[model samples]
Each structure stands twice: as structure tokens, then as C-alpha cells.
Target: MQTITLDALIPREDFNILSSTGSSSNTRNKQTLSIEDLKYDSFFFSALRKPIFQRETNEWDAEKVCSMIESFVNDELVPAIILWRNQGGYIFVIDGAHRLSSLGAWINDDYGDGPISISFYGNYISDEQRKAAEKTRQLVNQKIGSFKEIEAISRNRISTENDLKNDIAKNLGALAIQLQWVDGNAAKAEDSFLKINQSATKISEAELELIKNREHSYAIAARAIVRAGKGYKYWSAYSITEQEHIVELSKKIHQLMFGIGNINMDDINSLPIGGPLNSSLTLDVVTQTVRICNGLDRKTKTNVGDANEVITYLRNTLRILQYINSKEKFSLGVHPFVYFYSGIGKHKIGSYYGFLMFAKELIEKKKIDNFIQVRSRFESVIYQYNFLVQQIIRKDRQSKRAYVSIKDYYVLLMEIILENPTYSNEAIVEEIKKNDKFKYLQTEIVDNETVAVKSNFSRGKKQQIKMETFVESLPRCPICGGYICSNSVSVDHIQRKQDGGTNAVENGQITHLYCNTTYKN
Candidate 1:
């Protein structure tokens, strides 16, 4: 689904400060907000806030958001937005956040790249986000026209050349989004929200866990790292020093995992942990990284009473990430394409987590050097037989279980490589088949179903052909002889700089960061 991200449309605020048992004294809260009331500078818009625990407001795609706006402009039967006004005079959305956000986005002309989003994300938006915003803006403008243009036409300040625009403008005055307000305390409001959302859209288990533990260390760290420490500061309550520390750690981890530019089939050499930096995918990646690094489970809710604990968790996660890709002495500088991506350029989360587990085991056993010794041959085998990684992950299905088997597979592969550095692919496969643990690695041959052939290749086939050609032409690191990518490559001096190495072409060679910094030395 082509989902449009309107998460920045409705800002989040902690409603816990409001009295849990108190209700709004004023009974005159409006039951509707007109387009003018939702303008960027309007008091009604400023007072509107999403509850901190609310899931991101990016569920609706471009078509859905535009459809909602079209319905509203036509005075169609749109659902009422549910809200709860606190005693402190702030209105928290109880339900229908997506609906309000869609209208707010259209009025403010900010699908995501607008002023609100820039301010909300601290000017650190991703390319993916920017592209999605542009797409939504174009779709909305093409279909329903901009809100300002429609209003101008409605007021007769501009010529209404377009019939559809004129009709929508004529109905603009009668457009009022009906509002249903919760009349109880914050607790009651929250309960209503959970019930309504659970029944209506059904929040995913992962998202529900995040919402329930929004204040916990893992959740906070995940949110910070996913946005590269730029979006809403869930850790804002912490001391300035601690907040700075959290941001520093979160930024390092984010860069390590997702700093590489967006990955596509054309540029499959370098892949990030969760593919791109989308809100949903990155949340899963960060959440799993935090849990795995800290030895926490899915159900463990470790609350962050202070910023210190959040910083600690972030630092731990950062250490693991650094070890995975940094230039540190023990860092593996593991290439994502070699380990995580399949031969067909698809990212396998099962392979990613499995490699992480394997790395952690190496760290625990102080055997990183053992892996480093055979790193070249190991990476070669992995790159050449990438299909095996795909097959193993495909058979396992469950990511968690697949990761365990993958980790064991890595161990088994390393063992074989250590014993015989020049093992052939067939020899390795035969050996693996002998082991009952990896009996699933048995080769399966299925005859292709006969069908009418077409002149043009299917999309998947074209991608596979392209990937095969690209893989064949990939460059190798001179130091460890492993495949190097634009993101992971580092230039090193062939001759030691201290030994009269000059800035000449002959003095330089391409290598992985770890190899260039530590292995060569």
C-alpha cells in the first residue's frame, strides 16, 4: 500500500500532567471545527494534540487521505472526530487522528515537508519521507486542488475555470467535521481510545507494545534512533545533559544502521538493517536491536524512571552497532549486502538478525579474530552462494527461529572454512547435508510449470537478471578481498604514510574500514 506519512500533522503531547480524575469545567466545547479553525495559525488547531501513546498518524495512504478530503469538501457523510478536553484546556485526540490529520495536512499545505513537519522533525527528514510528501501533495492538488485556491474561488477572489474546483469551493462553507468529545477524566478518555482504535483499525501487536511502554527505555530509544534523534523527544523530560547524551548515542546508532543512502534494486551493493528509514520498518529494527543488545524480551517492560537508564540502553546498542560496522579494532565491518541481502537483492530480516546473533556470540567467545582470519573466504562463500541464505530463511519462515538456524549456519560455515580454506561450494553443501541440524538445506528441485511465454520478461525476472549482472561486476576490497560498496569503502595508503607514502594514485587502495584501519596495520 502506498501510505502517506502525516505523522507530523498532529503533534504529540504528554497528557499525564492533566489531573486523571478531573474533567473540563467548560461545557461549551465546540462539536465541530471548520476549515478556518484548522488553519495553521488558528487557536483551535494550536490547541489540538495527539496523546503521547497514540500510534503514528501515517496509516492512511495518499488515495485514502485525498478521498477523505474529497468527502469533506463534498459535505458527504464523514465520521466525527473523537476528542477529550482536559481541565488544563488542551484537547487530546481519542480517535480519528488520521481523519483530522488529513484535513490539517490539506489546509496547511504540508503533507510532511511543510513548516509543521520541518519543526516537528527538527529539519532532519529522510529522502523517503520527502518523496512520499511530494507524491501526496501532487495527488491532492491534481484531484481536489489546494485549500487556498479552493477558498479563493469560493470567495470570488479568483476565476473558477475548473468546474470541479468551483463545485468543491461552493460546498466549502458548509463543511464542518463533526466532533464527539469524551466527557470524563484522562483515564476514561484513554480507555475509550484503546477500545475504539482496537475495534476499528486494530493496532498491530508491535505497535500496541510500543504504545503501552512508550515511557520505557526500549521504546524511547527505538523512537529516538528511528528518527535519528530528530523527531519528538520522548526523553525531553530528562536533564539537558542526559538528553544531549541520549541524542548523541541515538544519532551514532542511526548513522551506523541507516546512514547509507536509500537502497534499491539498482544499487543493491549496500543495504541497511530494515531497508529504508520508514517509521514502521525502522521501529521494528531499532526495537529489536535494543532488545537483542540488552538481552530483553518482547514482554519485558523496563521503564525509564530517568534519562540515565535510557542513555545507558542507547549506549549499549550503539556499542553493538559500532562493533558491527565501525572502524574499531574488534569491529567486523560486516557488509550488509554480503550477509543480509539475497542474491535477488531482497533484504532478509532473518539473515540480518541471525548475523547479529552470530556477532554477539563471537564477542562473547572472544573469537572475532578467528572470523577475521577467514573473513575473505567466508564473505566469498556467502556472496557466491547467497541463494543458500535465502533458502534457509525461506524454509524457517519465522524470523526469530530463522535467525537461530542462521547463526548456527554461520558457525558451521566458519568451521568448515577454518578447516579447509579452499572448500568448493558443492563440498560445503554436501557437508552441510550430512549434518542433521541443517537437513533443511537439502536441495529441492521442482520442474517449472509449462505456460505460454511472453516476449517481455516479468518484473521479478528482470530484477534477477539485473542483479546477476551487477553482482558479477562488483568491486572487491584489496585488503581483505571482500566485496566493497560505496557506503562501506575506505581508501588506504599502499605504503605507510609515515614511511614516505605520498598522495599519489599508486599509493592508494580501496578497502573496508576495519581492514584499512586495523587489519592492514
Candidate 2:
């Protein structure tokens, strides 16, 4: 197998290319330019006040970039580069930012990891994006060679040096292919972008919404936080101090979700921020969660309030999420089944967002402490009945129905925890079965075809053995006969030490403090 790294793909002519094309900020006054004209560094891509939406740069994978570069070099009939001139007279690319950036990356020898790309996106290009550029460069070199090599190859094709030079001049020099300049103000330019991109491939609905209302606070906060301030800073419109806070807050939120720690452990039962599934789901969830939490109807229909005000709410919201996963509080931190993962081996986007919706409810009601008090019991009930939750989630998966069903579980869980601070797993299960929506899950259990359901949560006895292997894994509380989590729990002698019980691991078990201290005492 072949491996590609960032350094392996660097062209020997990178410095020579940079040296040959000395700095010149000459604007492209002409509407048409050929592939050959792009070799120079003079054509500045400063068209719009912001050429590309901040969150969306280098989103194209290597194959797409490489294919685009090859298409341009082969002189294929490609789409026109849409241009719009700003008040500063800078020619900005309205629709072809990624296309132009791909070509520019080729000419400049800067595939995001390069110094030029570092400066381009303000040093926020992510590792995933940088690797993508590297892979693309490798593909481009394998297929079409570097820009200088392509120039040399074009020259080499002819036996006569003069003839080769003539070929380069005639074919490569003819930069005029196609260009469409949109004459308009910023709003008009944005509208053109939205209309043009509706037909373009690879633009998700979430991305389209963000592009359409890039100025909205939900959009701004989501973009800033999604990539951990490692992409274009959408919060650039805010004051410098506000921008700093946005970056800081975004970093914290990013860490909370994806940080390498206890929450993201190798153990399958670990608390989940996310898992390896849809790469784009993070941005979508964060952006939508912002709108959901802040009560924004839609990017177009709703006013997202002031940028600073949105940032303030987002920061607090993120902090609340962070608090739930904090190690110091109830060590349960986050329960994977409740928040991010279904009991089945699938990453549940519904579970993630549904839990956040629940968190938003908690924050709104100022019930963080109250929730914290019963978190152990809540986790216990859910853990013991993991198969039931998995059954509900697996039925819908990523559809709209999945979100509603999972949210129904969240609502019921919250209500039960609120009404009965110390509830039994059987009670919670009974409560869930009473709900009309969960009636189907109960029917599966009553039919005794739980083989499918059991396989999801435990894969049968193997999972039971795995669960038993973990030293910290405790059984249900003996006194209350409820599920137990590692929070406000007591280690008691199975047969009280006073009654001749030893403090051996086999002789000990975990129970809730109330059960051990009040009842067992």
C-alpha cells in the first residue's frame, strides 16, 4: 500500500515557482483568462468582502481538487468563473472559490499546509483539510504532474524547442476561457451565490442555509464553534474582544465534544461526543442546535438577534454542556446511551441533539442541580434498559422520526427524574411502555422475540462477560433494588462487616448513599 504525507508531495519547483512569479497584486480587469494566465501570482482573489463563506473553504476532497485541476489543464469545457467587484475594486469569486482556490493552490504550490495557505485562512486550516490537500496534490502530480512539470511536459512534447515554446505560447497563453461578472452590491452578490449554488453539487442544506444567512448569529456561532476556530473566523464582523471570546468559547466547545479524554475512551460504554460516521454531521448538529436552543425559527424567517448576544447565549450553552461532562461532578459525566450512542453499534445523531435539547430545557428551567442530583439514578435506569432505548432509536435511525422518538425518550426521562428523584429501572420501563409511541417496543418484548433486541445491547452473554470484567461495573442497588451509577454511591459489605463480612472485592458491592446510609443502616 502507498502512503501520502504532506511533505512527500512538495514540488522541487515550489521555491522556483514562487521566485518566478514575484509578488504583484494586479487585478484581473479582463472577464476572460486562460489556464496559462493562472500560472502567475498576480491575479488577486479579493472579490467579495469575503470571497467564500468562512466555514466552507477547502471542503472539496483531493479527488475533486485533482479532477478540477486536470480538467483545467486538459482545456476541457468547464463552467465559467463567476466574479463580482467590491467597492475596493477587488475582483472576488462569487461561486467558483473552491475551483479557483484549487487551481491557485496548484500554481502557488500551497495545498493548505503550505505557507501561502496558512496565510490565506489565517492559520486555521484543520488537520483533516490539510491532509485532504496533500492527497489531492499527490493525485494531481500522479495524473498531471506539477505546474512547472506540466509546462515542461507541454514544451517536451515537441522535438523542436522553438516549436515547443510556440505550443506553450499558443495553448497555455490563451487564458481566456469563460467569466461571468455579477454587477451588484453585497446583498445582490450573496443572492447570486445562493441561486447559483442551488444547482451545484456537494452543497448540503445546512451549508446552503449558512451561506444564505452567513450574518445570522446562529450561523456565525455555529461556524465559529464547529471547527474550533480552526477555519475562517465567521465572527470577524464582531469587535476584536468579541472575536477573541468567540475563539476561546469555540475552542472550549470543540474540546468538550471531541477532546481526547475519558469521554472519548476506547471502551464502548464511554461517553460519546460523536463517533466515526458522517463528517459533516458535527457542523449540522451544532448549527441546528444553536437555532434550537436560542429559539431561532430558521435562518431566513427568524432574526437571530445581535452577533454578541448570540455569542453570549452560545457560550453559556456550551458551558452547560461542558459542565455535564466535567469529571469532578458525579463521575458519570456523560452517559453514552443517553447522549450520543444508541445501545446498538450505531452513532446516533438524534441522541446527541436530543440530549442537547434536554440540556437546553434544563438550562432554561435552571434545573442543573436538580438534574445532577438524579443523574446517577437516571443513568442507572437507562443503562439497565439499554436495549429498550436502542430499539426505539434503531427503528427511525437518522430520519426526522428518529429525532422525535429519541426526544420523546428524553422528555419522559426528564419528567420521571423530576417527579421521582429515585426511580427504579422497572418503573421507568413501565412508564416508557405506557407511552403510546413506545408501545411497539413493549410489544416486541411481550412477543418474546427479544433475540433481536438482546443482540443490539449485549450481543448476548459476551457483552455480559465484558461488562463483568470491568472492576468498576457495579450491579443494581441491593436496598432500593434500582440501577446504580458511580455517583454519590457507597461501597458496602455484601454481608455487613459487623456481621462477619470481609472487605474483599467479592464481598463488596456499590449502592446509592441514601439506600446504604438510610435504609441499610
Candidate 3:
């Protein structure tokens, strides 16, 4: 990973713009700065820090960042860049890390989508993020032009190309941004960051919680995993050997979740575990890890009170996910049910949490073997009844019931698997209706109309139809229980035909031909 000095990243302007000349104490009272001040004031730029709790750079898209620049050029109601003064004369960004970073990115040409962000965050950006950045770069370029292009124009204005310079002067040159400084000490600064960010931030509550818990092993591991070891080194304080372990395990999980795209960007063909590559899934994965390993109740908040325990939990969580994704061990067919699936259709966080809870139950209750034994049959049901399965997942997912609702459904899934019966869609729906927790969800409507709208059931049915093409596109295999690469599958008699078994539906089973002849025979 490359570490860059602030000076190396900072761009210099042609004119020498110094900090306000006054008594040091008196100058400290000024709480505002213009774009020119940000550009010229060495101390102002030098003292800026994107707080630890601040979001990753990629959280804001290029267009959003560019909008801020556009707003600056347009001189609109741009918000103040909140700052906190340190013990010396240093400054820390409290509530405007994204705004500040965007300006810095524009100045430094390090829009979290490119090699600059990769290098800045120690070379850990995902392909998804790089693509996003590339798009941002295009948008920024198309909308506002690159910094170099504008700078060149700015430079040439003093020479013969005065017309071009004058045309862009307002858009590129003559604008100022307001800065607001927080009063009090470092604690107050942190408090201000939290309070101000509560309303201004785009980060979710769970993600903020993870940022707040950064010191914990799970948080560090999650940060490492989410960025695919491309972001800031949260585990830097550990011993080199421990750091290696963290890196190795995090890489293993990262690859399992995201593939080796960070290492070999070109080979990335399939979507990652978190569809569309939402970094917030890292928080969910971390939370589930801690909750499962510690055997904590689902309703309780997962915390960082125990670092060692958290590390162990993450390891266990990685192990389970690895097993689920493994080709050899417990090949779960169509296991995307475990993660959020927002491709052509809608899937929810409940799908992600539900899988975690299911895995936890399997691990804790020593039901792995039972799950494996019935896995083939269970997967058949899930494959055939994909619509109802998603409907059940969606019904419970409303009002943020992912963490709780998944467990209820997982229990139902286990029961269905254990019973070894042909579960019709109606039967499944009936069972879901009987579920005390799902009763209210059974007859719910999910629209924002003034009066009662169509039921969520109707919506899910339509969604289910939309999803049919996708589901049919998936390779169906009952033996190995995943997408089949083989051109043909063998249907064999459960009771051998030689034993006078009738050709009944109950007597037929699907299996890989290799399994039917080579193994079963």
C-alpha cells in the first residue's frame, strides 16, 4: 500500500494566499473560508482531517461531489464546512468530510473512483467502486471539466486567451465557500460530528455504528473486507503476524464475497455476494459475525466490547460463508437468498440477515448434518417455489424486520426440510399466515397512497412474474444443488425399477448422471 503525504497531494495556486494576518487568538475566531482560502491557505488545508468516523470516500458519487462544485460556481446555498480546532492550530473536519474530500479530490484529481483513491486508501478499491469513479470522472468532466483543464484556462487568462478566461471566470474562479468552526474541545468536536452528521449524512445507522466501533476487531476486519483490503489500514496497530492473519482472513472472505477483482480486475465477470456491491453489507456481515459467534440474541445490539471474541466471531462467520460458497462442501443451490439481491428484481436485507441467522442456528444447534442430509430436497423446494420463497422473505422484510423476520422464516424452512413433504405454494403461504409474527404481514399493503392500495401479495406476485425469467435462467441441479454446467441430468427411480417400483412422481428423483451411475449404483 502506498501512503501519500498531504503536501504531495495538495495543489499549489499561482498566487501566494496566506492565512489571515492578525493575533493568532484573534484569527482563530473567524469561522468562514472561501474556495480561494481553501486553495491558498497552507495551514487551513494542512490542518484538515477526515475524521475516523467519517465515511469512506466513495460514499458520495462523482455527480454529487460535482454538484457541490457546481453549487460553489453557481454561488448557491451551499452548507458550511464545519471544523474543529485542535490543541495546536490544526483543524479537523466534523460534518463536511464528503464536501471537503470532494473539493480536495477536485484539487488533487483523486476522485475516489480512480488510481488516486486506490493509492490513497492503500490500493483496496473494488471493481464496482472503480467503475463508479470512472463514471463520476466522465460526469464531472462533461459537467465541469477536469481540474487541469480549468487550471490551464485560468493560467492562460492573463495572456492572449482573455475571452475564454472571462467566460469561465465565474464558473471556475470567482467563488467562495463558507466554513463554520465548532466551539470547545476534541470531545465536543466528536459530538458535533455525530450530531451534525445525524441529519446531513447519507450513511445508514448501521454503517455509522460500524464506523463508531472501528477499534473493534470485527469493525477493522469488516473495513478491510469491504474495501477488499484497499482502504485505510484499520489493523495497523496490531503485530505484523496478527496483521498478516487479519489480511489473509479478510482477503479470503473478501474474495469469497467479492472475488479477486482487486488483485485481477479484468477477470471479474459475475456479480459479487452483495449485489451491485453495496459497502453497507460489510456492516451487516460484521454484525452477524459478532451476533452468531457470541450466541447473542438477535434483538440485542452487537457491540465491540470484546475484541478477541469479535475476531473469533469473524473467523467463524467467514468459515460458514466459505462453506456455503464452497463447491465441495455443502454446495447450496441458488444461495443468493442469503444476501441482498437487487439485480433485475427486488431482494431485501432480510435475505442477507436470514441466511446469517439460519447459518447460526445450523452451527449452534449442531444441525449442520441434518441440514446437509435434507439439503437436496430443501433446495428443490426453494428452487421450485422461488416466488413464494421471495414473497415470504419480502413480507417479513418490511419495517426493517430482516434481523428478526429471517429467523422466523428460517425456522419454517428447517421445518419444511425436515418434514420431507411436497410443499405446495398454497401450503407454504398458509404456514406463513399461521406464523404469529407473519400474520400482520399476510394481509399488508405497501404503497404510499392516501387510501388502501393493492396488497403486497399482489405486488409480490407481479414481482415474482418479473423474476421468472431470471430464475429460469439459473442452472438447476438437484444433486450438487447449484447451477449445473453439465448438458444433461439423470432422473432415476428412488426405488429401483428392477424392484417393481412404479413410475410415480414420488419415486422419481433428479441427480447428476455421475452421481446416478458412478456413486449411487
Q: Which residue pairs overlap in candidate 3's backbone?
A: 113-133, 124-230
The TM-score of candidate 3 is 0.73
User: Per-residue lDDT of 412-520 in model 1, one digit per residue for the tens?
Assistant: 8888878877777667766877788877674554549567676788787788788878867877777767666665567888888999999999889877777777767
lDDT of 2 by residue, 316-338 (tens): 65755654453433222454434
TM, every model? 0.90, 0.66, 0.73
lDDT of 2 at 290: 71
Which consecutive 10 residues in model 2 have the weakest lDDT in total? 8-17
In candidate 2, the residue pairs with backbone N, CA or C atoms under 3 Å apart (3 or more residues apart, or in different chains) clash, namely 33-175, 33-176, 34-175, 34-176, 47-91, 47-92, 124-230
Displacement of residue 126 (Cα, Å) in model 3 is 2.4
Model 3, residue 71: displacement in angstroms? 1.5
Best candidate according to TM-score: 1
- How would you encode candidate 3's per-residue C-alpha lDDT over 1-521 as one tens digit per residue? 11112211322111112244322242445556655545423556765556655554445555577797667655677787777655555566676666666676666666654445555556566555556556666776777667667776667654324444345554555666777778776667777777787776555766676666666655666666655544456666667776667667667666666553332211112434443344434455545544554455435665553435535755876766654453333333234532345323433555655666677677678676566555555555445544444566666545655555666665676576567456664565466667676565343334566786566657655655655554455554444454432223566687888899889999887654444554455
Segments of candidate 2 deviating more than 4 angstroms: 1-29, 36-40, 46-55, 120-125, 151-176, 202-212, 230-233, 260-278, 295-307, 326-332, 335-338, 342-346, 363-405, 414-430, 440-521
**Model 2: what TM-score?**
0.66
Ten-residue stretch with the least lDDT total in model 1:
15-24
Instruction: Enumerate clash totals for all models, in the order shown.
Output: 0, 7, 2
